[model samples]
Target chain A: MRDAFHEDLDKISDSLVEMTRLVGSAMSRATTALLDSDLGLAEGVIENDVQIDAIRDDIDEMAVQLIAQQQPVATDLRIVVTALHMASSLERMGDLAEHVAKVARLRYPHKAVPPQANATIVEMAQIAERLVAQAGSIIAAKDVDGAEALHADDDEMDRLHRDMFVLLVDEGWEGGTESAIDVTLLARYFERFADHAVSVARQVAYLVTGEWEHKRRVGAPA
Target chain B: MRDAFHEDLDKISDSLVEMTRLVGSAMSRATTALLDSDLGLAEGVIENDVQIDAIRDDIDEMAVQLIAQQQPVATDLRIVVTALHMASSLERMGDLAEHVAKVARLRYPHKAVPPQANATIVEMAQIAERLVAQAGSIIAAKDVDGAEALHADDDEMDRLHRDMFVLLVDEGWEGGTESAIDVTLLARYFERFADHAVSVARQVAYLVTGEWEHKRRVGAPA
Candidate 1:
């Protein structure tokens, strides 16, 4: 019974890691869709979210069953619970990606702001996507050190977020009302996506270290 | 041994509910501070955050100990895992309230936008606070029906958020760039606060039903 439970648990973790990969790809594609104003790609992301949700449900069911049947103890229990939390975070990341795609669909054909403003957004997106990917890798490898490194990526995204805000304000001052509003919304979306990625990294850190990192003060690096 | 473990679990759940109350009050006070431009209240919210974080840590440690020592089975295990998820969500809710307070501090003494816009924000804040408070009540009472009722409150928040966006854009066309930017950031903060409240509600639902709620579609009523 115990061995069978272990196999079931492993399968659940495998599904969670797969879901994380899908979400990471969805986010990367969403960013590309935004930059290129490709409504088709955005629509594809929106449509693919059902699969992510289905995986989340399957994991939850498996985890609950494991606890009910095998009655996990200590590290095994932590592993199951962590998988559930990670699944939720991954699903939220997917939702944020879909939100980005929706914005792309809404404001297509016209760049939200000047090309320079978008450059910062693109940079933040890259960092966020990489963080998500690295988080999945760390979970798969159970590498505490690799999970810790994800915070630096979050710091980079934070710096880019601040720069985006400053640029938006400067553009507003320079009489770019329409473009500035678009830029502000776009920047906010990317900042939120980064926040969710930080959330994923924090969960991974918790799973490995059993410690929750402090929420970094805005001015400081994570 | 089992009786002692159950008693300890009860105590931990009580503490989790208490922490939820602290976070809900923090959010309410922060919103009022924003609307009144009361720096003292905003500062008070920031200062009280230490207590919230301390409660979070205490609950986390207790949960970990319960899982390690008690080795709870099935429903009991779910309770422990749920507590961990709840603590994390409450911590994030506190951070969101702090973010709102920071905005209050930044735009202090000079009402960044008009009173009308401020009123809308205050409404959003009130709804968010109520939803969080209800989440705490549901957890404390174990009332699934109460949680379901609060579920619809997120829809109200969504509608108000859309209205705020429209107001911001329209104001940009009429009230000039500065007001538009202020409204834009303010909208983002309120929208995020609502999102956190939705998260709290989802956690409550999970605790009651042992399942995840689907992500509410953007622009759809709750």
Candidate 2:
């Protein structure tokens, strides 16, 4: 049987996992919105970000309340503090998704991503979804191995980012400066989304293994 | 007389101010490097980021240790919790400055800011410096007014960011796709740096007034 403090911690953890799910869905839809230029779907992702922020607020309040009431020490305290950080990362992921959706909206009926970079954007979107999904599993199960595997997914995202850059600078590239700007920003959003997912996974791994380096500040350092 | 916990909190607060200083200097130097294409200065900013990371690690350890040893509750606990979030924002500001510096290095021997957009970049960098400097003052003084004033500075940042976009997409833009890409990312880095500064200020202000909204999750939400 769990104590009240542990119960609160579990709820916070559960909320975090729920956050991962919502953020995952957010990015998944935002990716579709970007590629398909679906205005309504883009609007939905932008509007729903508030829900993610609300969950973060709840987690923040819960963690602070837990600390004041339980006065947990040592590892328990670390868990609470780290939960705040993870909540933060999750919230930022939601914002990044919103940014993607807004980009789609800005372009309207025209697709934000051009043809040369479509495949890479699609793959990045897929990996972003997988990363956050795996981040959910990692948090729920505290699976360190799952955390270790997330780095590879992030690596692929980085490679796709580089490929996009190459296309942007290519001599034969048909996309004009305006398209290039949109693509560059879009690519960065996906890369950062994947990064935050990996950060969440790494934090979970560290909390489980008691081996956080504290150096993973900016979501895997690109 | 201040108790041991307050003393520790003071030290943590001091470190946050120090972080603002480091991050401020970093942005100042990064701007110079970007404009002048100074390889050595850019390299210095990139290398010195580790020190910023180290301070954050120190702040993290100090905060968690305080929580373990002090068991602070009520407003005191909120102050400590808010400190951790402030440290995070400052650290991210450091990363953004480093990113700006890296862009400088990437375009070494060639200026990152083109002639058309030079003035805006300079103005953006100046505001970034002021924002961090004021963030330091706000943290040290715990001034609510200082915190409130930060919003205006951030609004200026947003304005500058918009001006940058106008310059980029203008028909008269001569920098081509690559420069547009670089300018877009650099502009974002400065804008985010300012946002984080405002976030730190708001956290300090809230800790002082005991009115933290918890909705300022992603640093004032744009």
Candidate 3:
């Protein structure tokens, strides 16, 4: 019976890793599609997001069932509950990638991102993909160090987001309001994608340390 | 023992309702702050979001404890798990409200939504507040009809969002790129607020009917 419960817990972890992998791939492909104006890849990323959603549902259902059946307490319970949060953040990440893909599709035959903004956007996408990959490793091993590093990775994404915003609103920006909107929204999607990854990493850190330290960083009023 | 379990379940439901109420108030106040450029109200809303976060933590802890201690099965398990999802959505709604307040605070002494877009933003705020209030009632009563009606309310928000976008991109839009970003983001905050309310409502509907819906409506791949 003990072995069975541990197996269930392992399966939950496996599902989370699977979700991270799927979402990471989606972000990478979506970014490429966005950069290259590749409609097929963009459509593929959009199509694959459903799988990410389904996996998230499965992870959630499994976590709930594990708690209900095993009656896990303390650390074990925290791990299961944290899995739920991680799955949610991962699923949202996938949706952000889909948003990017949709934008790619929306502006097909014409790149939504102008040349001036492309480098920062590309770098942001690379950082986002790297963070998710790191997130998967963090989840699989409960690596607190890896989880902590995601914060810096997310900082890079934030800097890029700020840069894109500056470019969009700069006095000399020749990109019209439509392109401005496109890049603005695109930068946000990439930035939010990294934010979700950081969130998932924090969840893992919480699970490992049993201390919810990030709460204060969020600026929640005392 | 059974009665105690049911009582604990009731408490969980109460926390969810309370969370919805806090989020609703925050959105209403945030909107007013945005329109009036009231720094104090915006600060107040930002400060209050911490309480919503605390309540969410309380809900999650309670739900985890209930499952671990009672080992609830079937419908009882579903109720506990759904409450977890509801708490999460409500917490996110609060954060969205806080985002609006932050924007309001950021543009202090200067209006975020220019005169041309003010009416639509105000209407969106009212609708957001109304939906959350209805969401609170729906959670308390588990009213399926009320939950279903939130979809229509959210559709109204979507219409407003589209209108705001069109206005932003219109040839005559004199709001400039900065103001355009402000309104565009503001529109998203309200729309996402409604979307989160709809998500909670759908959770309630799923609880009552045991049929999973709204996943497709989110535009996730099939």
Candidate 4:
């Protein structure tokens, strides 16, 4: 019986890792769709997000069932709860990718991101893809060290985000208000994508370390 | 023992409703601070968010304990899990309110919304406050009809968001790119706030009705 429970636990981990892979692909494809104005690719990414949601729903359902039936305690319980949390973060990551795709679809042939900010947006998308892929490995291997290292990727994404803002708000900038709005929101989507990746890594860290890394500064208005 | 478990479940519901109230107040105060440039009020909202987080942490801890100890089944297990989901959504609502406060602080001594957009932003904030307060009653009473009514409020918010976009992008508008960026992001923050509120209402509807609402569109981007 205990073996069966452990097996179920392993399945949950597998499901989360699977979610990460799907999310990573979604981000990568969504970026391509945005850059190339490829409506078909953008539509595909949006369509696949449902698969990510289904996996999340499955993991959540399975975790809840395991808790009710197996009556896990201590670390076992923590693992199940953390899996649920990770599933949620992963699903949000997928949704962020969908949001990016939606922007691409909204702009169609015009391209949501302008040429001036294109390189930076591409880099941000690459970072988001890499970070989520790494997040998957961290969950699969339960590597606390790998989870901690995700912070660097998050920092890089943040740097790109800040640079994008600076560029858009520069005095000599010529992107017009509409393009500025698009780039600003697009940068935020990528930044938030990385944030969710870090959040998932933090959950993985907690699952392995049994101690939360940080309390997120309770009064932080932002 | 079963009766005790049921009582604990009631307590979880109460905690969620309490969280809703805190979030509602935070949004209201943050809006005032943004529109009025009231630094003290903004800071106060930021500070109070900690209380919301503590309540969420408590709900999470209690729900986990109940699941572990009682090993609840069927609807009992569903109720516990839904409470956790609701607590998470409410906590995120608080964080969104904090984000609004942070923006207000960042722009202190200067208004975040321009004179033209101020009234619309204020209206959005009011709708958010009303929706969340109604959400509190929905949770407390498990009022499915009230939860259903939240959709109209969310629709109003979406309409405002769309109109704000049009206003910002119109050729005659003169808010400048920086101000345009601020208003755009502010509008998005409020739109997302409403989205989260609707999500919470959907969760409540699920708890009472046991049917997920429309699966949120599987494809077509956005």
Candidate 5:
């Protein structure tokens, strides 16, 4: 029933949904790798990121082809354009996961996150995994309400990000500078992962609702 | 002399060049604020980022409008899409600079970079500034060679990043945990800034040469 142009768009959308799965899987396994110091799992996350990047390239190519052939104006054009931006955000999310896995890999034979920060790191990873999964749902259904709901989880992620610093700066902390550096970068990777997810959700909302919220929400860069 | 489509694209290109200036200035000032502990200078960089972000939004709008109106295909379409991506990278470079400023602000009345790491941070900032300035020139001229030259600076940035980590973990280091956290984050903000500059340069090369490099070169997250 779908025309060629719509069919191409559909394929692009499906590929995007697949990206969410790959990125989500990468982050979940990367987190486990971080917590357990699983070198194999960490290596897997880093190695598989090329797949995510490849999908992004394919989506960009498809979107450009659609634009050139169909010349769809107004809403159709906006969707394609917004999809390009979304693909970049998702690719960056994969990179963040790869970054987390690198930390795990770099610390092989030792836990990247110290015991004091263990519970917080676990919670951060859980929220990150959920956010990306929701991002996938938001894209599949084009659900603006679902996109808006991502805000609460992102807020929770930010809270955890701040709480992480509190633990790092606590006087009783004894993780040493190396573990502290690891935790600082690790927390940022998780926090940035959530930020990118929220960014993807916002782009979805923009297209679905046709309103661009240009408000900047980046509290602090890692 | 130029048709309306090329004229519109010329405007977008001009805006992109302007972005490089604003972003480069922000990073330069942010580094100063970080090293000198100048709260006022840091605040200025933080406030001026909105200007950088605004230009990116304007460029995106212009690019989208150009695509819709002109219906460009092939090389033309690719160029417009690449501009959109370059805009995002430049905007992120601004945010990274702002992140550096926030680190300085957070450590007000106390220095953010300990003396041991100060020289490397300064060198990193200098390279970040040069890369963005060159990014601007590359955009203005579409100089593929200039874009290619950015790799050397980025390689140096990476080497400094690795060097910073070595300093953090050294047994003789005495910057304390808080200072280490500050330096860790500050070092990462600088490193990511250069990465984005490299990313922007790569986009220019992609459009000019009609060749996209599928290589993955992210050394680490932080």
Candidate 6:
């Protein structure tokens, strides 16, 4: 029975890793589509979201079953429960990507704001992707150190978000109301995406260390 | 030993409910401060965050201890784990309220925008508070029905958010950049707050029902 339970838990973990990969890919593609104005890629993200949602449901079902049958205890219980939380965050990450794709489709063929603003957003997306990827790695390997590092990555995303706001305000001041509004909303979505990823990382940290470490690691030494 | 374990579990639940009450109050106070431009209230929220943070730490510690000692099974395990997720959401909710308070301080003495925009935002805050309060009740009573009702409440917040956007964009076109930018960011924060509350409601539903209910409740009479 213990062997069978362990096998089931392993299967759930694998599904979680797969879900993370798909959600991360969707986010990356969505952001790239926004930057390059690639409606085709954006459409692809929207379409692929169904698969992410399906997987999220599968994971949740599996978690419920594990609890009902296996009656998981100790670390086993934590793993199952944390998987459930991670699944929810992964699903939201997908939804945020879908939102980005919608924006991309809406603004297709029109450049978004100034080059600098677009470039900053792209950088922000990159950070978000890295954080999500690291979260996946921490979950798979239960790497506490990697999980700790994610806090700094999240802080950088926050700084970029603040910068994005400054750019949006400056652009609005310079008479680009329409484009500025688009950029501002887009930036807000990406910042929120990053925030969710940070949330996933924190969950990973809890799963690995068996503790919730709230103090964010300030940025790496200069 | 079983009786002792049950007692410990009760303590954990009590701590969770206490934290919930503190966070809910913080949100209410923060929104009131925003509406009234009360810097003292805003400062109180900023100062009170440390207490929230401390509560979070205590909950985390309790959860770890409960799992380590009792090795809870099934519903017991789910309750403890759900408490962890709820704590994280509540912490973020408090942070969002703090963000609003910060905005209030930034725009102090002078209103950020017209009374029309401010009134809509106040409405949004009221809706968010309702959802947050409902979430607390759902957890305390394990009321799946109440949790389901929050989904509709969330939709109302979404509609109000759309109205705010329309108003902001109209202001952008008519009232120029300054007014539009301020209202846009303010509206975005309130919308995000509602999103977090919806997330809390979803978690409550999952805890009670063992299913991943969509954040949007279906089949309710429009």
lDDT of 1 by residue, A60-141 (tens): 6687677767765656666566667677667777877887788787778754446766678788788877877777776677
Computed on C-alpha atoms, the DockQ of candidate 5 is 0.62
Off by over 4 Å in 6: A1-13, A54-88, A108-116, A138-142, A147-156, A171-175, A195-206, A211-222, B1-20, B53-84, B147-152, B171-179, B198-206, B209-222
Clashing pairs in 4: A221-B98
For model 3, residues B76-142, the per-residue Cα lDDT tens digits are 7766767787887888899899999999999999998889999999889999999989888887897
Candidate 2, residues A183-211, lDDT tens digits: the string is 99999999989888998888886565445
Q: Whole-model lDDT for model 4 versus the true structure?
A: 0.80
lDDT of 4 at B149: 78
Report the Cα lDDT for residue B140, model 1: 81
lDDT by residue for model 5 (B135-199), tens:
89998998866767887898999999999999999987878888889999888888888888877
Number of the top-ranking candidate, with DockQ as the measure: 2
For every model in order, the TM-score on chain A comes to 0.84, 0.94, 0.90, 0.92, 0.92, 0.86
lDDT of each: 0.70, 0.86, 0.81, 0.80, 0.84, 0.69
- Considering only N, C-alpha and C atoms within 3 Å, which residue pairs clash in candidate 1? B155-B222
lDDT of 6 by residue, B20-131 (tens): 6777787788777777878899899878877876776677667756766765565565556566766766666677677777767777775565676767877887887777
Per-residue accuracy of model 6 over A1-222 as CA lDDT, tens digit each:
548667887788778778778888998999888888899999999998888878866775676566667655555665665666677677777887888888888878875545768678888889878877877776688665676677777788889888877776663445267666777777777777777776666666555543433333311110
- Candidate DockQ scores, in order: 0.34, 0.64, 0.48, 0.56, 0.62, 0.23
Q: After superposition, how far is residue A96 of candidate 5 from its true place, in Å?
A: 0.5
Candidate 6 A-chain TM?
0.86
User: Model 2 chain A: which ten-residue window has the lowest total lDDT?
Assistant: A213-222
- Give Cα distance to truth, residue B12, candidate 4, Å: 0.4
lDDT per residue (tens digit) for residues B1-222 in model 4? 448787787788888888988999899888889899999999999898889888977886788787777777756676676677777778888988888888899889998778988878988998888888888888888886676777688889999999999999998777788788888888887887777777776677656654433323311112
Docking class of 5: medium
**TM-score of chain B taken alone, every candidate:** 0.84, 0.94, 0.91, 0.91, 0.93, 0.83
TM-score of 3: 0.93
> Which stretches of candidate 5 lie above 4 Å from their native place?
A1-7, A213-222, B212-222
CAPRI quality level assigned to candidate 3 from its DockQ score: acceptable
For residue B176, model 4's alpha carbon misses the true position, in angstroms, by 0.8
Error of 5 at A50 (Å): 0.6
